[model samples]
Target: MTEKDIILTSEGREELEKELSNLINVIRPQVIEELVEARAQGDLSENADYDAARNRQAEVEARIKEIETMLSKAKIIEDSNNLNKEIKVGTTVTFQNLKTKKEMTVKIVGVIEADPFESKISNESPLAKAMLGKSTNDTCEVRELKEPYKILIKDIK
Candidate 1:
């Protein structure tokens, strides 16, 4: 499938930019210094420090590349500053299970900022897809492996 446009809010974008800056300015320099020190130790075949430093450099560069790519294709979404009574990105939504009486609070956010463990779901998730455009008091069903459950949108902020 084609990659969906990665959405990000201003704060999220700033976070990514800050991370990129840190990786480039601080981490990269530290890794380079470590590599220099490791190389000074001489034995190429048995240099664990050199190997580890090189590996870390590779990982850091890879992350820089990924971040650059994301920033290049970034499609920043407006935060909920002026949003009315609609469910949109940057909005904290609370839903309660109709049958099981379970409650979940999810913040719909850009794909990059999605952290399910933190209750931040991407707009592309099945639950977010069903919740979009839905208003308070509306019920939606989430189909999982075991059973389908219904959730009522209790509030949005």
Candidate 2:
């Protein structure tokens, strides 16, 4: 794996840790049991159950490794230095659409934790990119979008 930092929210890190624990504790044991049961069924040649069990095992192991690596280099987004309420990772901001005058609030998060349905947008997103480092009442245009748009930062926390 590349030696670069993996940005993550605290909640994201906790979720990953929970997933790793589940894989190691519960899924790993179940896969081992499946392998044992499949092996007891006789010939290794053309054993569908055994093949499926092996595949599942491989997937589980790969995910565990991935999560481990991510957690190892994870950099949790910190809001401690954000006394001015500047838009940045881990900060929630309310912005108004310049054209429509529609208002919405969203929390900026890392790519791994971004969930639009939950109002958590990635820092690399066009809107977040345009708003980052800007303060309340700041107006910025997101030109990277297909239909470029502007937003007025109403509030940041």
Candidate 3:
């Protein structure tokens, strides 16, 4: 079966590659050493160290596979020069909440790079979806909310 393409920024791709490298080059070797040391302790049935090492090996291997799969299917979102004209992935958007009269800024990024706490939202998110392709001063509705809220696009950069 084919996996869906994972959208990622260059930084997000780098982070995944770094994690995969660490798992393959460092964590895998360390876990192998742990397993070797555990095996030297004799009977595996009553050995807590042996069980722990085995568990760690399984987890590391699983993660390595997962990362490899993701990397294989990753589609990197490249930076665009038209960011100043319209909202798009990698663009920092400033908007105003019509109801609450609050102004906020958020960076639209691929799912892999999104961090809500840092005001970085994924393009797949409701707000970002509504705002995508809109230019400055355009109004958009947040459909995900129970009571739809209108947001005025203030700037795009």
In model 1, the worst 10-residue window by lDDT is 77-86
Per residue, candidate 2 scores C-alpha lDDT tens digits across 1-157 of 6687888988898899999999999999999999999999999898999999999999999999999989999999866667877777899899999999999999999888899999999988988899999999999998773789999999888
Listed per model in order, the count of residue pairs whose N, CA or C atoms clash below 3 Å is 0, 0, 0
Q: Who wins the TM-score comparison?
A: 2
Q: Go through the candidates in order and give each one's C-alpha lDDT.
A: 0.88, 0.91, 0.91
**What does candidate 1 score on TM?**
0.90
- Write the residue-wise lDDT of candidate 1 on 105-146 in tens digits: 999998889998988998878888888888889988877668
Question: Candidate 2: minimum summed lDDT over ten consecutive residues — where?
Answer: 78-87
Q: Between 1 and 2, whose lDDT is larger?
A: 2
Model 2 scores a TM of 0.93
Q: Evaluate model 3: give its TM-score.
A: 0.91
Q: After superposition, how far is residue 87 of candidate 2 from its true place, in Å?
A: 1.0
The candidate that wins on lDDT is 2
Total backbone clashes of model 1?
A: 0
Q: Is candidate 2 or candidate 3 better by lDDT?
A: 2
Q: Of 2 and 3, which scores higher on TM-score? A: 2
